[model samples]
Structure formats: structure tokens, C-alpha cells
Target chain A: MTWAAVLLLAAGTYALRLAGPMLRRRITLPEAAVRYCGLGAVVLLAAFIATSTMIDGTRLVGPTRPAAVAVGAILALRRAPFIVVVCGAAVTAAVLRLAGLP
Target chain B: MRLIRRTVVLVRGAGLLRDVIAVASAVGVVGASFGAMAAAAGVAPELTIGMSLLVFAGGAQFLAVGVIGAGGGIAAAILAGLLLNARHLPFGLAVGAAFDRGWATRIVGSHLMIDESVAFALAQREPERRRRAYWMCGIAVFVCWNLGTALGVLAGGAVGDPNVLGLDAAFPAGLLALLLPSLADRVALRVALIGATIAVVATPLLQPGAGLLLALIALAFALPLPARRPGRRP
Candidate 1:
């Protein structure tokens, strides 16, 4: 099942990546559609971040993870390097958990 | 005049290579986290590495692993990944000229069409410089990212439960970082907020990946309203 998912995703994503270049002269996407596609990606990513950070399966993982993620978000907004943002979140979560924050 | 221009481009290319390496290193770090998180989530080492090798899109790979790890079905995982990667369509268009050499280059270049590589390519004004930036960044990132993932998978095996060290938090954190830049646009921010709210609210009620799918409803808000009623007077 996992292999199938990976293969499908790989194929589909590659197609999308290839579509624009391959069809550039053959077709032109509507301006609105293009803009929406960009916006849609942002929406999906935000949604994913929220659910993954706050909920695990059907249960809320509690505040520790969210708090750590918050730190990472702030660092990212400030344009911190990717490594710092990641390590900062991990460290914050580990420290909070160590202090019994759950 | 042509020879002088070529010399200048070559000189600039040297500096661009340095910048591309720095960006590639950052991508490598995130790639490592992805490998470790996926492995810790009980993904087979081979599968984790395979996804990194083949999929190569950090956001999509991370989303797929997260969905599957939460017990979502394979269909949901693939769907989520495809949705996250939708941006690559425009990306390919914007950088198409970089791959104009031939079909062979196009196939491999499409596979290398990542956010950072495209960004680096677009930043250059000259077509020659742009092509150089694209290939240099793409190859550098590919090599570093794969190496990093391999190292991370090995490290993940040595480590015990990922949660103890908060490695689990790293996935969401990395995702949040990715989303941050896009949030700068006002409409995108509003849509993101709405989408996030829907996902959070629907999470408990719906199955794991279903809630994330439901968030697509937020795009309705992003769509432009119909034609301003055929140009009525303001």
C-alpha cells in the first residue's frame, strides 16, 4: 500500500512538474486559475500544519507540540536558517516535555 | 562585445554557485529531519529513503508520511501529496527555458524542478546565468538532500522513541516554516487561517486525512467573484 502511494505520488507530481514546460506553447492556464493554484497550496499547507501539530489521529496531543511549533514559526518568519528553526522547535519541545508540560 | 559579456557572466556564476550551495545546505538539513521523522514513525528505512529519492519534494513527502503515519489510507496520502505539489506546474512554466536543450534534459530537469532551484534560477537576469543557476542548484540540492536523508535514517535507527527528543515536533515545525513565506500575502493569509480552522475543527469528527481534504473548501473564498456583473457602473 505504501509503495503504491509513493509510486503514484511520484508519477503525479512529476507530471505536474512537466506539464507547464511540455505544454507551454500548446496551452495557457487562465490567470485566475494559476493564482488560485498558488493560493490553494498555501491553504493546504496551513491546514496540514495545524492538524498535524494539534491533533494526532483523532486525539489532541496537547500544548507542548503547538508551543514548540510556534517557536519554529516565529523563527521562520524572521528568516532564520532552516536548521535553526527545526532545532529550535525540537529543543523547545524536548525542554517542555522534560519539565512535565506534556 | 560577446566575449566580454561571456567573461562577466562566468564571473557572476562563481558567486551564484556559492549562494546556491548555502541554500542547498539548508535544504539538506530539512531533508535529514524528514528522513528521521519518517523512519521514527515506523516507515521502513528503504521506503523512507525511496520516497526521498523518487518523490524529492520535501513538502509532499512530508505530508504523505504524516498522513500515512496517522493511519490515513494510501489514497489519502497520495492525494494530499499531489495537492501540496500543485505549485510545481507554474514552476515548470517559469523555468521551462532552462530545460530547452532537449528531451533528455527536460525529463531530468522536470524531476529537479524544486522551489529553491527555481527561485535561484529566476533571480538571475541573463538567460545563460539562469540556466546555470538552475542546473547548479538542482544538482547540488539533490546530492546533499539524498546524503542527508541517508544519514538521518541511520541516526533514527540508533535513537529510540522520537517523541522523547521531540523529533516528532520537527515535522510540523518544518511545515510551519514552509507555510510562513506564503502567508505574507493578505488573501493567502486569510485563506490559510480559514483552511487551518476547518482542518482543526474537522479533525476529530472526520478521519485523519479527510479533515485536511475538507480544508480545500477554503479555496472557494480565494476565488474571484463572477465578472463584476458584466461591468455595472461603480
Candidate 2:
């Protein structure tokens, strides 16, 4: 079942890769769609990030995980460069560990 | 013959070799995050690096790692994670149109047409600039990614108790950082705010992937709400 899932995922992703170039002309999305497209990219990226970080193993690891998230958010707001963003996350995580939170 | 020269130039511009640093900057963080996650999970450091080398998709890597860490079947994790990546299809298609297709060019373009590269290419108003940006970003990502994987994996291995260091934060924080620059509009802001908040609030209620998927759908179907006119100055 798992292999089946992974293969399905891979094929689905490949389809997306193939689709981008194949249908470039046929679709004429409205201005709203276009704007949303820009937003969608960021929005989706955030949603993905949220899921990946806050919830692990179907439970929220509040102290360590959320702290890391807050650190990332702070770094992002400060417009810290990418390396700084990573460092903030690392430090948040390190603090969590030092506090003995899972 | 003029067109041939242009296409060659376009392809060269789009491929990863020319602007290696830009690509690395974009792909490196994501690659490192995945590399570190894999390392933490008792995945052979080689496999972690290989994910960057081979998979190159951060969401998919996250999915694969989450599943693996839980001892979920490898195959299942691969599949679920991939479902999230399906969005790339339309993104790639959008990019593929900018270039006239030939067998080799099409194939290569498809391989390189990731979200960042494609968006960057499409964002370019000029045909040649579009092509060049696309290729450069893609190639940069590919090259930097493979190299960065080694760094991340080694870093992961060297850190004692990778969990304590909060290495997992790299993936989300890195991605969030990549995403922030792109959110420069109002409708996008609203929808993103709505969708993101929904995801955060509803985190307790839904699967992470499914919750996010739902947010995308809600944002997409949010037609009944007033549509903001362009240049209207919200």
C-alpha cells in the first residue's frame, strides 16, 4: 500500500511537471486568477510549512515545535536572510531541547 | 536560423549552469532541511543526501520523511507526499508555453520547470528573458541542491541529537522564507491569510496535508466574496 502510494505520488508530480508546458496556450485565466496564482503560491507554501512544522505524529509538539515556528516567523518578519532564518530555527530548536521538551 | 540561435540561447539561459549561485541559494535551504530530517530519522546519511540529489522536491521530501519517521511503509509515504506535489503540473504547463517546443527542448524544459523557475520565467515579460530566467533558476536549483545535500547531511550527522537542535525547523522556516517575498498583493494576502489561519486553527482537526489541501480549495473557490479589481488600490 505504501509503495503504491509513493508511486502514485511520483506519477502525480510528474504529471504536473509535464502539464505546465503542455497547456500553456489553451487556458486563459482571468485577472483574478492570475493574481490568485501569485498569492496561491505563497499561501500554499505557508500551509505546507505550517503542517510540516506544528503538527508532527498527529500531535502538536507545542513547546519545541511552536517555538521553532515562532522563531521562523520572527526571522521572516525581520527580513532576515535565508541563512539567518535557518539559524533562528536551529536556535529555537536547540532551546527547546535544552529545556528538555520533546 | 535566427530562431535556432534564439532557442539555443534560451535553453542555455534556462539550464542550471549559468547562474549556479542563484539556484543554490533557492534550493540549498530546502535541500538542507530534507537532508537533516532524513539524517535524524536514522535514514542513512547517504539516502538523505540522495533525496536532494534525486527527489529535489521539498514537499515530497517532507512527506517521505514524516512517513519514514513514523515507520509508515516507505511506499505509502512516497505516495502521500507526492500527492501534495501534484500542483507542479499546472505550474510546469504555465512555464512550458513560453518556449516553442522541440523534442529535446521540451523534455529538458519539463525536467527543469519547478515552481520558482517557472514563475520567474513567466514573470518575465520578454520572451528571451523569460526563457533565460527559467533555465537559470532551474539549473541553479539542481546544481546547488545536490551539493547542499552533502553539507546538510554532514551537518545533521555532526549535530548531537538532531532533534534537540530543532533541525526540522529548517524545512518549514526555509520554505516560509522563500514564500514571503512572493506575497505582494491584496487578494492573495486575504486568501493566504484566510487559508493559512484556517490551516493553523484547524490543525487539530485535519491531517496536515489534507488541511492544507482544503485551504487551497477554499482559496480557489472563494468567488462569492467580492473580487478586487486590478489597479483599484485596495
Best by TM-score: 2
For candidate 1 chain B, the 10 contiguous residues with the lowest summed lDDT are B222-231
Query: Of the candidates shown, which would achieve the greatest DockQ relative to the real structure?
Result: 1
RMSD of each: 6.5, 6.9
- Chain B TM-scores across candidates: 0.67, 0.64
**lDDT for each residue of candidate 1 in A1-102, tens digit (9 for 90 to 100):** 367777889999999988878876467778566566556656666777788799876688978999999998889888886667777888999999999998
Which lDDT tens digits does candidate 2 get at residues B1-234?
999998986775544233335335646655665666667777777566655544566667776778767878866686666666665654554456555366577766676655556545644567777777677777778776767667778888553444555666755675566556455545555676677776666656754556666667646645654656646885
User: Model 2 misses residue B158 by how many Å?
Assistant: 6.8
